[model samples]
Target: MRLSHKLLRDAALFLILISMPVYYLAFTYSLKESSKSRELIVTRQLTSFQNTLKEALWNGDSPYTRQIVSTLGNIEGVSSVVLYDDKMEKIQESNSPSKRIPFSHDMYKELESNQVKQIKTKSEGSFLVSLITKKTDQGLEKLGIIKIDIHYNDLIKSAHARSRTMLAVLLGIFILIFFIQFLYLREFLIKPLSDFEKAISEMNVYADIKLKEDPNHVFEIANLTKTFNHMGEELKNSAGIINQQQMQMINVSKMSALGEMASGVAHEINNPLMITTGFLERIQKAVQNDPEKYSEIAMHTEKALKGTQRVAKIVKGLRSFARNGSKDPMQEVETEKIISETLELCFERFKYGEIQLEITKTVSGKIICRESQISQVLLNLLNNAYDAVTEMPSKNKWVKVEVADSADQNKILIYITDCGPGIPKDIASKILEPFFTTKETGKGTGLGLSISVGIVEEHGGKLYLDHGHDNTRFVLELPRA
Candidate 1:
C-alpha cells in the first residue's frame, strides 16, 4: 500500500488495540454489578417473607404457616421457596414444576446466621439461579429460616442481550470513527502528496514548471510544496548554465584543432620558400659586378625572399605548436628526444622572459608512448612552468624538467618544477578542472591542464601535483612501453 494509506490504517488499528480491551473489561464489570444489585433486592424480599412466616408460626397453628409459605412461593422470579426451623429441619417447601431445589441445608445455615446473603448455583437443564435470604425479625424473635431461589438464567439472558446490543453500538461507533479519520488523512496528507507528485511529473515534461499553493492543505504539506517548487526552479537554472558551458567547450576545442591544422600547412610551405630565397641570394651575389644591372634587382629580390622565408618559418613553428597530431602506434620512444622537442617549442618564451630552463635526465631508456601526444603534454607543462617562473622576481626565477626510470624499471617518471609563488593549498586540488583558471580573465582558457590530464590517463599513466617540496611540482608517471 501507499505510505499515507498505511499510516492511516496503522493509526486506526492502534486505537482499536488500546480501546477494545478497556471496553470489554468495563462491560463485564457492569454486568457483575447489575447482578449484585438484583441479588440485594431478592435478599430484602426474602427477609420480608421470613417475617411473615414467623408471625404466623408464633401467633397461630400450622394453617397460618402454610398460608405464609404459599404467599412467598407466588412471588415473581422466585424459583423455590422453603421454610426451615432454627434447628435446621425443613418446615415447608414449595417449587414450580419447571424448577427443583437440589440442596437446602447450606441455604438454611446461611439464613440462620443472621447475615443478609445471596449466592449463585446450577439448576436443572444447564440453568443457573441465585439463592438469597434475610433474618426473620427485627433482631427480636429468632424465627424459622426462609430461602428464595431466583432464576439467574433470566438475569444472564438479559445480560447477554444487553452485551449484544452494546457490541453492535461499539462496532457502529468504530466504523464512524474510521471513516472520519480516513477522510481527514486524505484531505490533510494524501491529496497534497498526490498533487506534489503530479507537479514533479509535469516539471519533467516541461522545463521551469511551477505549482500553485494549495490553500486546502495543512501547514506541513504547504511547506513541502513550497520546497519542491523552489528545488525545481533551482535545477532549471543550473541546467541552463551547464548547457551553455558545454557549448563553449565545444567551440574552444574546434578552434584549437583549427589553429593546429593552420600551423601544419604553414610549416609545409616554409621548405619551398627557403629554397627560393637561397636561389635569389646566389643570383644577387653573381650579378654584383654589373652596375645598373641584375645585381641591385637581384639583391632586393633576395632580401624580400629572405623576409618571406623568415615569415614562413615563424608560421611553421606556430602551426607545429598548435597542432595536436594523431597518436602513433605504441612503440619504444627515446625519452630525451621527447623532452627536447617539447622544450624547443617553448624556447622563445623562455628566452624572452630570461627564465632559466633546466633538464636533468637520470635514466636513458626507451619508454612506451605515442610521441606526439607525449610531446604535447610535456610542451604544455613546460610552457606553464616557464610562465610560473617568469612571473616571479628575476633572482629567484628558474624552471626544471626531470626524467627518470621508476625504481622497478617498469615505468618512467617526469617531474616539472618551477620556483615561483607556489600553488595555494586551498585551490591546488581543483586546478585540473576544465575552465577553472587562476589566470586573469581572457588570458587563459584553462583547458591545458585538464586535457593534459586526460591524455596521461589514456596512456595508462598517473598525473598529479606533488606539494611535498617548497616549489610547485607536477609529476607524471607513465607505464613502460
Candidate 2:
C-alpha cells in the first residue's frame, strides 16, 4: 500500500483504539442519567399520592380511597397499584381480579428501611411501595402500605436515543481526524516524493546535476534529496572521465590501423606515380620530336594528368583517414562516397596477381557520422578481409565486399567476406575482445574488431560476424540518416 493509505488506516485505527473506552463510558452515562430522571418523576407522583391517602384514611372515607386507587392505576407509567394492612396481608389492589398481580414478599426483605416503620420508603419493582402515615399526638401514625408498579420503558428508550446521538458525534470526530491526516500526509510527504521520482526519471548522465530543493519538504526526505544530489554529481563526473578514456582508446586504435595501412597505401600511390612518370616521359619525347604533332602531345599530357590524379586520390584518402575524426561533429555524408574513398587505401591488395577483389554497392543514402572514424572502422574490417583471403590456400583467393541499404528504413548494412569458412562457433563470442587475433603474432594487432565495435556502437549501430554467411563475413550495420 502507499504510505498515505497506510497512514490513514493506522490513524483511523488509532482513533478507534483510543476512543473505545470513551464511547462505552458515554453510553453507560446515558443509561444512568435516564434512570435518575425516571426515578425523580416516579418519586414526585408517589409523594402526592401518599398525602392524599393520609387525608382519606384519617376520615375513614372508603369511596375517596377507592377513587384514589382507581386514579393511580390509570396514571401514565403506573402499571398497577396495590394496598396492604399493617399486618402485611393484601387489603386492596387497583388491578381487576381477573388480571391478578402477585406481590413479592422478598421486596420487604430487599428494602433498605424496616418494613414495619411509620413511613418507610422502598424501590420501584413490579409495584411501587410506600407507607401511608398521619399526624398523632406524639409521633407520625402508621396507617398501611401501598405498592404501585411504575413502568420505566421511556427511560430505556431515552437511553438508546442518547446512545445513538453519542455514536454519531464520535463517528463524525473520527472521520474528520482521518481526513485531516490524509491531507497533511499528501501535501507534505507524498507530493515531494513524487517530484523526486520524476526528477530521477528525467535525469541525464552527461548533464550537470542540480536537483531542485523544496522548502516545504519533510526533514527526512530533504536529507535523502541531498544525498541523491551528491550521488548524481559523482556520476556526472565519472561519465566525463569515462568519455575521455574512450577518446584516448579510439585514438590509439586509429594510429594502430594507420600503421598497418601505410604499406598498402604507399604501394597503391607508387603504382600511380610510376605510371604518371612514364606518360610524362612520352609527352616530353613527342613534343621534342615533332612540335607540329600537337594532338599526340595533348593526348600524352591528358594521360599523364590522369595518372597524377589517381596518385592524388590515393594520397587524399590516406590523409583523411589519418586525421583525428573525433573532433568532428556528426553530419550527413554520402555512404557510397565514404566506401569508395576507403577502398582506395586497399587497392594494393588487388594489385598483386595472387588476390582477387570484387565489390558490390547497392546502398544509396546519406548517414550521419564522424567520417574519419567510420573510415577507420571500414579500413580495419577491409584489412581483416584481405588478410583472410591471403591466408587461405584455396585457389579462389578472393575478397568480396557488399554494401546495401537495408529493407528497413532505419538501417544500412555492409558485409565483407573472404574465401574461408566463417569464424568457428566456439571463439566467435571472444573475437570482439581486445587483442584476441587469430592471425600470426606480428601481422595482427587484434584491436581492429574491438575498436570497430566501439566505433559502430558509438554511432548507435553494431558490428558482428554473420555466421549464416558461407564464408568468413563481418557485418556492419549503421543507422540511416
Candidate 3:
C-alpha cells in the first residue's frame, strides 16, 4: 500500500485495539453502578416496609399491616413481595403463589443474610431481591423476614445509556486524532520529500550549486538537508580540481612530443647556418680590398651577415627545445623571450609548409617558471597550429600567437590561434586526454596537448581549448613574478 494509506490504516487499527478494552471496562463498571443504585433504593424501601409491618403486627392492627404491604408492592419495578414467619410459613404476600410460600428456610436465611441480591427466578428477566428482618419492639428479637423482588430494567437501561455515550465520545476523539495526524505527516514529511525530488531533478551536475536550506521544524529532515548541502559543495569543489588536473595532463603530453620533434630539426638546420656564416665572413674580406667595391658590397655583406646570424639564432633556439628531458628549477624569465625562442623552432616549419605565422606581444612581464618546460609548451602549441593549418584546404593558411597581460595583474595570457578548421565540437573535450587524437594514425601521438597541459599546471597556470570561435584558440595563462 502507499505510505499515506498505510499510515492511516494502521493508526485506525491501533485506535480500535486500544479503545475496545477501555469501552468494555466502562460498560461493565456502568452496569455495576446502576445495580448498586437500584439495590440501595430497594433496601431502603424494604427496611421501612418491614419496620411498619412489624409495628402493626405487634399493635394488633390488621388494617395497618395490609396498607403497608400494598404500598410496598405498588413501588415501581417491584414484581413481588412476601412476608415469612420463623418457620418459613407465608403470612402476607403480593404477586406471590396463593397456596404456600415457594421458598425453603435455608433459602430465606441465605437471601436475608445479604442486603440485596440479583437472581434469575425462572422469569424472562432477572430480578433484584432485597431482604429486611422483622424484629420485636426493642429490636432485640428476630420475628420474621420480608423479601421483595424488584425488576432490573431501570438499572440495565441506565448502564446501556452510559455505554452509548462513552462510545460516541471515543469515536469523536479517534476522528480528531486521525485528522490531526494526517495533517502533521503531510506538512512535515510528505510535502518536503516531494520538493526535495524536484530540486534534485532541476540541478546541474557540472555547475556549482547550493541547495536551499530546509526551514522545517522537523529535526530529522532538517539534518538531512544540511548534510546534502555539505556533500554537494564538496562534490562541486572536487569536480573543479579534477578538471584542472585533466588540463595539466593534456599540456604535459604535448610538451613531451615537442622535445622529440625539435631534436631532428635542430641538427638539420645548424649545419646549413654554420656554412652560411662562413661564406658571409669570406665575402666581407674579399670586398675590403677596393674602395668602390667595398662600399657597394659592404652593405650587401652586412645584410647577408645579419641573415646568417638570424638563422644561427633560430638553430640555437631549436637546440634549447631539442633537450630530451627537463628537471629545471623555477626562475623569473621574460615572457616575450620565451615566445620568441619557441617560434624559432616552428618558424621554418611554417614557412616550408606554406603557412603564415603571426606573433603579437601586447604586454611584457617576467614570469616565474622552468624556462625549458614553458618553451616546450609554446613550441608544441605552434607546432599543432602548423599541423591544423597544413591539413586545411584553405589557400590562406596562418597561425597567430598573441602574448598579453591578463586582466589580473598577477597573470599573463598567451593566445595561440589558427586559421584552419576549428576543433570539432564533438571531440573537443577529449582532445586533451592521453592517446586521444584527431590526426590520422601514425601522424600524431595524441600526447602533445596532454604533456603541455601538465607543464602549465606545474607552474600554477592554466591551459585550455577555447570554444565558440571560427578557429581554434588554445590559451596558456601563466603567473608573473
* lDDT string, candidate 1, 389-468, tens digits: 77676675788888888899888899999888888878898889777778887666677788789888988898889979
State, as a TM-score between 0 and 1, how close model 1 is to the true structure: 0.48
Which model scores highest in TM-score?
3
- Return the number of clashes found in candidate 1: 3
For each candidate in turn, the TM-score is 0.48, 0.45, 0.61
RMSD value for candidate 2: 15.5
The lDDT, on a scale of 0 to 1, for candidate 2 is: 0.73
Runs of candidate 2 exceeding 4 Å displacement: 4-27, 48-60, 67-76, 92-103, 110-128, 131-142, 200-211, 255-481
Which of candidates 1 and 2 is the stronger one according to lDDT? 2
Give candidate 1 misplaced runs (Cα > 4 Å). 4-30, 60-63, 97-115, 120-142, 194-216, 266-481
**1-481 per-residue lDDT for model 2 (tens digits):** 8787788788778777867676667766876666555545666666777777777767877688888888877776566677766567666677654333455566554543213211112322234567676668987666667776655566557666777788778778878977887788788778877877887887888766566767778888888888889988888878866865675576577686875586467667777687777868777776776768877777868777776777777777776777767789998998888888887778775657377766765668888999989999988887877766676777777777788877877898888887855677888998898667788877776778887899899999999988787788888899999
Q: Model 2, residue 343: what's the lDDT?
A: 78
| Candidate 3 lDDT by residue in tens digits, 185-218 | 8888877677677667765557555555667548
Model 3 alpha-carbon drift over 4 Å, by segment? 1-3, 58-67, 92-104, 110-142, 193-210, 262-312, 315-326, 330-369, 374-481
User: lDDT of each model, Cα atoms only?
Assistant: 0.70, 0.73, 0.74
Q: Candidate 1, which ten residues in sequence have the lowest lDDT sum?
A: 123-132
lDDT of 3: 0.74
